[model samples]
Target: MAVALLVALTAWAFIFYVNMIDEVHDSIDDGLDNSKLLIIHQANLDSTVLAKQSFDEGNYAIRKIEGHHALNHYDVYKDTLMYMENEDDLEPVRLLTTVFEASENEFYQLKVISSMVEEDDLIEDLFYSLLWLYLILIVTILAINTVVLRSMWKPFFKFLNHLSEFKLGKNEQVQLLKSNVAEFKLLNKVIADVLESNIRSFHNQKQLIENASHELQTPLAIALNKLQLLAENPELSEEVVNEVFQTIETLQRLTRLNKSLLLLSKIENKQFLNEETIDFNDLIKSLLLDFKELIEFKELEVIFKKEDDLKVKMNPELARILITNLIKNAIRHNFNKGKIELLITNSSFQISNSGSDKELDSTKVFQRFQKESTDQSSTGLGLAIAKSIVDISGYRIEYAYSNSMHQFTVKFD
Candidate 1:
């Protein structure tokens, strides 16, 4: 917009300058004609043939000739030499003339020529002055506009700073100070609404998890105790014992599934605040040890590799749960005598396991209730819990399958 205004102003200045030059030329022509008339009247050259010689030599033209007491044959001297010659677009030289009889058989011809070159020079100077004046004005206006725009956007920067400091689910409320601009006020209102809705949803989900966990705990405990007593009966037949063990396994799977679901819900709600510096290599080694029995039971070759002592600040319980689930899934989904490779680096950890070449949709792998294999004991909450933990920790989790290998990678800052 500023550039456009400047262009228009410049064009107007050019046109005005040209008109000024034309007016100056016309004034100069008129002044010259008046001076010629004054010289003829003062010197008394009326009715003299010598005046004709002087006029011809002066480059003035005779426009008309008039007789005494007659309107015709008026000998008029018109100065055409001083008219503008270089400008082709201007009209050709023109002057008005008339013969006046001073006495009987005596007459003086008067001519008027427009000559205003001095005025043209003044107009030229004015044009340059106005051009420079407008240039300075435009520069000043631009500088002022930049400063004003920066001041108007100050509230937006403040709002961004406040948002940057916000922590999801942890902050109970977001307050934005009022701004002078209506657009900024509207933006703040929208952000506040979204934050409020998210906080409400988080608290509601947390309450549901708490209630469900508490209500189911007593019944699950009683059932487990009754099953334990039944399995210990002395008179139980072999088939009855086998059947009881299967029922017990099914009950245990349900209990684990419930616990995993509750843990995932809590992680999503950001319920825990126990954050400490944890050694990543140590955490992986400990989790692998817990899964040693499962690895042996599946007849899988488990290899753990790492760089020593990669430390990060996170909740220890969440970290343990994440790694345990990942390793458990790897062991459960592997083929007999398959290899499970756990590799830990400074910024990331990878778990790759031997599996079938059948492709799994990696995009949906982290979604809850998504399972890659049909293991009866597998809860399908393992990867989902890992994903939630990674999100809360500001880490990245990805899955890839190639060369008959399923790989899970967790990247940390």
Candidate 2:
């Protein structure tokens, strides 16, 4: 914008300067013509006497004279032309003459000369003054614009700084101070609405999780205890005992799934206290060791690699729950002879499994209530739990599929 304004101003100044010069040129031409006519008239009255007197007074200097035609020089005085080659400090001027017969035996010769210094100086002064005035005007306009723009944008800058410092999950309410501008006031109102909606949604979801967990606890415990009594009965047949054991396994899966869901909700609510230094590498290795029996039972190959002691400050319980769900999910989804690999580094931890489940859409796998298969024992809450942990801990989780392998990577920075 500034550049465009300067270009426009420069173009306008150039056009005005040119027009001013043309006016001065025309005025000089008219003056010179008029002066020549007057001098010729005066000389016609008495050419010899006036010529000789002009020469003596150095007002007219004759270069050459013929009967009625002569070539002379004129020195331009205040508003009149005089013939002088070396008078005062003025420059010498030359003129052309032609004799014309006004009547029989009567003739007149005219000389014309013009000085352009005064006219040139007038045009130069006008252009320089205009140029300086234009510069001052542009500078004044720019200064006013800077102050106005900064004043108008002050509220926006304050709003942005306030928003940046807000912690979403931790802070239940956000307040914005009133602003002078109408636009800023409207913007603040919109932000307040959004923050309110988020808080309401979070509380509603948290209440649902807690309510569901509490309602399922009593029934699940009673069912497990009943199944245990049936399995321990001495008179029970082998087939019946086997059936009871199957029921207990299904019940156990439900209990574990419910617990995981509740934990995920808590994490989302920012209920987990993160106040301890934890070695993430050590946590992953320990989880793998604990799951050795299950890994062996499935006849799965386990590969573990550790690059560095990755340390982070977080809730130990939440961190353990996060890693446990990831490892369990990998083991459960693997093929009979498939391999489950865990790679740990300073910045990231990755779990890869050699299994193909085309029905699984890797992109939506982390969404709550999304199940990869119709296995009744699978709660479809593992990845959701992992995502909650990742979000609360300020980490990132991503899934990828390549060469018939499924990989889940968590990065911490």
Candidate 3:
């Protein structure tokens, strides 16, 4: 802006300076015309003296010439350079020439000279004055724009800073001041609406999880307890006892599947907000110990390796469920006397088990109910639950199969 304005002002100043100089010359020429008339009158009255006089100090001169030269004469004015006794360099002057007739009828050419040094000085002064004015105006406008524009945008900058750091999961509600500016007012209203809708959705999901835990799981628990008591009856036959046990197992499986689905929903909805410091190494050892009976029944080779304790800040319940699912999936998919391996390090946890030689699809493996094994006892939701926990806890899980071995790796950072 400054450069463009300066350029425009400079061009205008140059044109104005030129016009002013031309106006000055025009005024000088008018004076010269008046002098021309007076000289003609003086020559008519005192021709000999007027013709004999030399030009000096804005004066006139009459030079005698042939009649043919007088016929060819025309009035003309021009600027010329001439050396003067008072100045070392050649000085500029304006010259006017025209043919005239004296009292004796003799032809002569009248020439007029006018000094232009003062006109040049005047133009220089005008240019400097205009340039100074342009500079002063430019500086003043810039200072005004900086102060005024910054003050006007202060409210907007404040709103932007708060909005960028806004957290939806936090207990605190978003608060924004109403703005007088139309655009800013619109922005604030739109943001408020979106945040309100998100809060509403979060509350709805929380209510659903709470209801399922209370209303559904409670009745299922009672039924399982009743089934257990019925199975313990002394009068029951062997077949009756077996049937009772099968019914209890089916109820238990149903209960677990319901619980897993509810847990997946809760994790996705961000319901487990509490966090605590837990040692993953200790957790893994305890899970392995819990499943020792299953490993023994299958005559599986269990290998465990870990470097040191891995401490992480997370929801203890969710972490336990995540690791439990991984271990359970490895066990359910393995063959009798299968080789099971657990490798734990500071950065990662890996679990591998002996299975079929064919590889499972990696894309479908993490999805719910996705499977390659035909095991009847497997729920197929184990990997999905593990994946949900991994996502919510901000960890990564990967799966691979090679050399008739299925492997699942969990990375914790």
Candidate 4:
């Protein structure tokens, strides 16, 4: 609005200045023309009027010129500087030059001067005046804009504040104050509909996951228990016992996979909202204790280096899962007697393990079921779950392979 006003006022000022200059010149020229006619009339009535050669007391002068010189001559009005004895300085004045026929074959040239109007001074004064006017108009506009726009947009800003506080599937609801504005009222309605739709979808997804958890795990558990009992029976043949044990193992892996998939779904649905400041240094130490037996069985050389206490604020369960999965991955994929390096810093947690000689596909490492290892027991959801947790927590995780080691780094902001 301010920019538009400036452009409009500038154009108006230029046009007004031009028109005012034209009007001033027109008024002065009209007066000079009338004076010229009256002087010519007097000169015709009395010859003495034509005898004046210079402007001594009057504002006009007459001088005779040859007929050929006056032929086809047009009256001209122009600005010129003339000496004024009263001011004792050169003053700007308007002059009119015209040719008049005094008698047959006789022509007199007349020059008439107008009272001085210093156009430079006029332009300077007009510039200052217009400048002040533009300033006043802008200030007034800004004042009105502050008061009126603030009042007009109060409901919109308040609505946004409430909307920001609203979370899907949470106890809190977006509570907006009544507004007189039609657009704001419509906005409130649309937002309410969208939130209701999302809340419904969230509840449906949550219920489905819960149902799958109960319905699937119960049968898997019963089958595994019966298989283990069959393996315990002395009547069973060696081959049958081995087969039963294998079946139990497969069912166990399936159970783990189901749990992983359900967890991934929950993470994607933004179900975990609880958060706390988690110290990675302490978390990693605690998790490493749980993986000590496996690490030792692999005969891995573990190198733990801590430069600082790495800390981040996120859901405690998810944070534990993220670190645990990475640690398990590092130990599981590592070759027997290979090296594993764990580094902690103020803002990052990194773990690198010696695994395949060839690098894994970085693009597919974080994707579900994209396993890089030959281990059939691997469910391939460890890295995917870690990645999901990092995403929800607003952290970043990256994969890189260098010096025949697979490295996963989780960076916190």
What TM-score should be assigned to candidate 4?
0.92
lDDT by residue for model 2 (1-413), tens: 77898789889988988988777766765665666565556556755533442344432332333544422433332334443455455553334444444335554444455655566577678978998989998898789878887788876787678777666456555557566878778888888899888778877877787788889988999999989987999999999999999989999998988887788768877767545998988788788889999998999998888887788787899889889989988988888889988888888888989776653676689998787666677788888998988888888999998667788999987
lDDT of 4 by residue, 292-405 (tens): 999999999999999998878899999999999999999888889999999998999999999889888888889999887778789999999999999988899999998888
The model with the greatest lDDT is: 4
How many residue pairs of model 2 clash at the backbone?
Answer: 3
Backbone clash numbers for all candidates listed? 15, 3, 0, 0
lDDT of 3 by residue, 38-134 (tens): 8888778775645454565536777888888888888898888866767877898888888887745678888877788887687678778877886
RMSD of each: 7.3, 7.7, 7.2, 2.3
What stretches of model 2 exceed 4 Å from their correct place?
Answer: 1-144, 151-155, 173-178, 226-248, 260-278, 296-302, 309-319, 335-339, 355-376, 387-406
Best TM-score among the predictions, by candidate number: 4
User: How close to the true structure is residue 311 of candidate 2, measured as C-alpha lDDT?
Assistant: 88
Q: Candidate 2 vs candidate 4: which has greater TM-score? A: 4
Q: Could you tell which candidate, 2 or 3, scores higher by lDDT?
A: 3
Per-residue C-alpha lDDT of model 1 across residues 246-304, encoded as one tens digit per residue? 99888888888898889987887788666899897878887778877878888999888
Rank list by lDDT: 4, 3, 1, 2
Question: In order, what lDDT does every prediction score?
Answer: 0.75, 0.75, 0.82, 0.89
Write down the worst ten-residue block by lDDT for model 4. 168-177
Instruction: Point out the worst 10-residue segment of candidate 2 by lDDT.
Output: 70-79
